[model samples]
Target: MTSRESALIDALRMIATHPAARGLADDAAVLPVEAGGLVLTHDMLVEGVHFLPDDPADSVAWKLVAVNMSDLAAKGAMPLGVLTGHGLGRDRDWDSLFVEGLADALRIFNVPLLGGDTVAMPAGAPVTLGLTAIGRAPECGAPSRSGAKAGDDLWVSGPLGDAGAGLAIRQGRMDGGLASLVTAYQRPQPNLPLGQALASLVSAMADVSDGLLIDARRIAEASGCGVAVQMDAVPLSDALMMVRPDSWETRIEATTAGDDYVLLFTAAPDRRQAIEAASSRHGGNARRIGCCTADRGFALSWRGGAVPLPARLGFEHG
Candidate 1:
């Protein structure tokens, strides 16, 4: 194994001292929690791949929470705590300020910091963020990507493509609200409450990390069903709306771009009203984007017409 892998495993082992992270599993880890199995998920963010080196500390920290929590929110898991693995600089002050940003995010998410490790990268090629988040299942159940069923109502917590917009502006791809797109990229408010409320309601659920079109396909395949999303129904923020509405390419940008951190869920028509009411109570924005069909085809409807899946799909690693 590489040294980096060894160090990561060792550090994770220490945090396992808690009731949650104990005796980690290699391929996958399972922790016995109080209420059913609290789904466990961890994502490692590399400086360039996940965030730019020039990104602000506060923004970076917020992105960490947004990404890790996205997993739990999709699983209908309640926030428990997060284990942070820090890679710091030789200068102590630089590292301390980073901690402050991370602390700020934890406060916002109401998620505790279980524990983590600290290490210095001599060359500092790219600092990595390792976050392990644990969340309990809802009282009624946990939502799974594989649970989607035919005739289910497909929905997303909010509009799509803000994070992609944020990245575009940052990379000079296009000029727009740095703040608005940034919020979609950073400080993502995981639809935790909505997920919990829909735990028993949603036939299937997943977070929109990789464009709606792509992630929706995942649910469809996993659940052995076909999905049809209405392009006009996909929500958009005032920030993303500024991206040249006349241009179909730009519109596709937001649609295919991922990292919105909203929940993509499917439910029975019978439960739509109840789900909407619950969402209002949770203070989450949700809307019906499409529907699931028994036929095995993934499609999108635009301007009252149906079309094949966009070739863009979503984020692809590698």
Candidate 2:
């Protein structure tokens, strides 16, 4: 009789009694293990919903692994291996490309393929893929999304909205020649090293799988605080700017667009120097776009004026 949210709460109450669950507030579950801890997370992607039916099978396979690895990055855990659930397609070429793409992702991320299962779906059914990523938590412990404190500065690992633009291209809403945007959508790099550097430094952290505003609001709700983002501070790829004009509307669209697997985290203002240094050391880009507030909601500001929130924050499954 319980709703999905309520059912999740009840299940957590029953199964997350152990201290290692991290109260189920993080992207991955942290369980105590020898010498340190283990971080486990699983993510699923479906055809037509997560990708265009004609999209490249290799890219789809890469996304399936990258998205799961992004969750591991959020936990500040180093990826050890992955288990894949592959739904065999009728097309032999597509399946072969998918394997190649899977191999590419595993090699790029330096993760091993532990094992997995494959099953043939019914004729005309959509393909569904799943990945389970296992990681080892750092000595300081994995970062949680519920640790942001008031006055902490919010930062993002890199630019946003390119993937959204890439999607628009794939949908034929835009002209061609923007291969960077297309590639951004197809191959997203998870900031694993930056996450490890922030494990002990940041108060809270998460990967930007959803819209930036929505993900920020999630952290705010979890930490029981408010967050105000400065629209001007959001980084945008040059490719996106060339396609879309600069304006508040464009900024809003960029922030609310999804599919960017960048890390969003909060750190003390005093740690600004250290954070920047860590980002540089990890060969990652970071920008401070907001700050945590004592209030209990999310806010947006630009040029000393408030920007109204959009009706839809980002891609919604349901």
Candidate 3:
């Protein structure tokens, strides 16, 4: 399951299989259009849940856009535009800053603002923002979480755990001296180009929105296979290492920590060269972390021994 929230989605899925929903197996809804299919996704961010009150409004806006874009990237779709839903707050200056951040994200990602609605909420209500992202898929079917096969090599686009480190900084648990960690948590870079390149090449793909363990399990469950993640192969950014020491425990936390929007995909061993070339072309430091197995769940291993699964896979809501 992609989320523990799947119980509600499962109930909705019982009645919501519109063919265009793709059985609700993939991240975005695909609607067959004239030239190709249109990929559509909507995501919401609450004030305290997704961002802190003291965090920059612009960064919050940027994160809202980036997170949605990350979903599109998973489907190997090129973003067309976005429609925003904004909850107006009492602080007009904060709202203005959010607009600036939103504008910056739009310009940076080359996605346009198609338009949306805004509402004035109660005085102290938390600000909630949502975005509906629309994209166009290629002639080939959009890559899906259910596409991974046994014997497929699993790969991740870049480093993990940096955002978790950044989150700690924002919470004042650590000094904000490490700019990379702070920036990673606040503004994430989705591998759009790599996604485009691997559209037809990879067997399955997803952006690591939740922790890597949970997200990888999503593909495994959707594909009806098992996934074995090599703990040592999980890459950690130098920035993260600078703040946290090098150890297996640190690696596990990095693997399970959320907010790193890196692309995780599976490809046949034969496609290694092409995958490497694509990553190089896109400025991504791709790593082969593990492989899909014929079994039914996740297995973690390092230094010739298996590691116990963590009690918690990732962030889960009550």
Candidate 4:
């Protein structure tokens, strides 16, 4: 394996503190919850993409925590702690700040620290981040994007586009409340408890890292059903509203921009009451943004009517 691949394997081994972590095939490191089920998740950040060229090491570390936590949120996993694989530059200050930011995230989430790794690299290389969080799912079964069902109602925890707009602002687009929006993009709050509350109610679940449109399409494809979204029903941040009065183009990009880190889930038509109850009990917001249809294709409601969507896609790494 390449050095990076070897690093990944070594990092996995370090975090594999649980029995299930033996194979390391699962996305997160799963472990028994002590009282009951299981919990696990992973978060990865790439330089120049997830962060700025001059991004602070601490901030990058915070993002490392947030992204992984977001995954656990989709699975309804409670924070246990984290294992980190951080790329180090020649500067020791950067490494310290990175750990500090990670510590900040741990404090906010009330999680503990597990062991991790540090490796030196040639200077000026792009910084990279990887974290795997262990947690408690209570029942061992966390939700997956693949479990969505036809005729189910789709919901998102909060507004969309803020994270994307944050990136735009950082990249010098329109700028207002850049801090909050950028913070959203930077330190996403994973809705872990809320996800657990939704466990029995949601048929399928996923974190909206990729834009809602793309993420929803993933769920649809996984469930072998088509999804229809009400463009008007999508949530928006106050910052988004200020800059995007003509939100038409913004909506399209935001719907596809990746890195929102909110939950997108599906519920049965008959389970609306269950959903409402779940939201109330869990203390999170969830709106019926759209529905899973028998159409066998993804569609979106534009200004006047529903239009068929081309193949749903996201950022290309290559």
Candidate 5:
């Protein structure tokens, strides 16, 4: 290996203190499986696509880790460790900052750095980073997206659109003043505790990464049911509402903006009280915004009137 690669590995060894990591000297991690089961998730971030070039290296590293943890949260699983695939770019200082950020994130999430691979990229190429998160599923079992049934109520762990608005602000498409919105975009907090509390109560669960509408429709299609969302009932943070007008258009934009990592779930109508209690106990503001229907397609309604579906639902790679 080159001196540069070896130096990077040595820096990583400081954070990878987990026994399974083997001090980053071994080719692979040796992890022990939990009795419940293992939950595995992988996510990637690209320089120009997933984040802006001017974004801080530390925030980028946090995003790479948090996004994967969000998947684990949806499964009601406790994180065990993480494996990262880092692309070494021309910016050496940026790489150093990313290592620092990774260490901070691992500590915050109580996850260990196991083992991973690093490779040098061509000069001037966009940097790419990948992470694989390992988690232990809840004893009750991890809820699947296809578990939703007709008559179930759809819920979200928190308000939507903050991250989307933050992106717009970052891109200069909108006015900037709300640092909270910007932080929401830069550092999203996965609702791990809420997910764990609601695992047994939810019929289906998934993180709102792509977009709420698209992710909900995924559940509908997977479960062989239809979902009708009430746009008026969709939750919006005070910060988002203050920045954008509270209208049907704004609601639609928020739902389709993507990058919101809150949990979107479904539960029986009868479980409303239990769900509410769980959410409250976990310090979450869960809101019911829709319901599963016997029909076979997704639909939307605004203030009791049927609204047409948008041309674009969420982000997707071509």
Candidate 6:
């Protein structure tokens, strides 16, 4: 290994205190799964795509970790540890800051840094980072996207559109002032406790990483059912509404803009009270915004009237 690579591993060794990490000397991490099933998730972030070039290195690191953790949260799993693949580029200082941020994120999530590999990037290549989060599935079992049944009520764990607005602000498409919205885009908090609590209650669940509309459509397609979204009932943060006028257009924009890390789930109509209680107990603002229908595709309604589906639903890699 190069001196820089060796130094980076030395820095990582400080945070990889988990017994499975083997002091970062081994090629792979050794994790012991005694009883329950393990939930594995991998997520990646790229410069200029997932984040802006001017975005703070620390926040980028945090996003890299949180996105993977969000996947675990969707599975209603408790995080075990994380393995990261960091592409080394020209910015050494930025890399150091990222290490610091990774340390913070690992601590905040109470997850340890396992073993991972690092590679030098080609000149002028964008910085790409990947993280694999390992979590223990809930005893009730990890909820799947295809588990939703006909007549189930659709729910969201928190407000939407804040991160999209933040991105707009960052891109100069919108005026700035809402620090909260900017922060939302920079750092997303995965609601693990809420996910865990709702594990047994939810019929289907997924985190809203792409856009709410697209992700919900995924659930519908997976479950072989139709998802009817009540556009007017879609939850928007007061901060988002304050920045952009609340309107049908705005709501549509918010739902399709993507980057909201909230959980979108479905449960039986009879389980509404139980779902609400579970969410409330975990400090989540779960809102019912739609329902699963017997039909075969996605539909949207606003103010009790049919609304045309947007041309774009959410972000897609290809």
What's each prediction's clash count? 1, 0, 0, 2, 0, 0
- Total residue pair clashes for candidate 3: 0
Range of the 10 consecutive residues with the lowest summed lDDT in candidate 6: 1-10
lDDT tens digits, residue span 112-158, model 1: 66666656676865777788888887777777789888998998888
- The lDDT for every candidate, in the order shown, is 0.76, 0.83, 0.84, 0.75, 0.92, 0.91
On lDDT, the stronger of 1 and 2 is 2
Write down the lDDT that model 3 would get.
0.84
Q: What TM-score, to 2 decimals, does candidate 5 have?
A: 0.98
The digit string of per-residue lDDT tens for model 2 on 1-318 reads 444334423332342333544554544444444677889999998999888899898899899999999999999999876766777654766776777787778878887665555567788888888999889998899989999999999999999999988988989987863799998888888888888998888999999998888898889999999999999999998889898987888787778888899999998999899999999999778999999999887888998888788898776668
Residue 224 lDDT in model 6? 94
Off by over 4 Å in 2: 1-33
Worst ten in a row by lDDT for model 5: 1-10
User: Could you tell me every candidate's TM-score relative to the true structure?
Assistant: 0.86, 0.88, 0.88, 0.84, 0.98, 0.98
151-232: candidate 3 lDDT, tens digit per residue: 9999999999999889988898877447889899999999787888888899999999888988999999999999999988
Which portions of model 1 show Cα errors greater than 4 Å? 1-35, 89-93
Query: Candidate 4 regions off by >4 Å?
Result: 1-37, 280-283, 308-313
Backbone clash pairs for candidate 2 read none
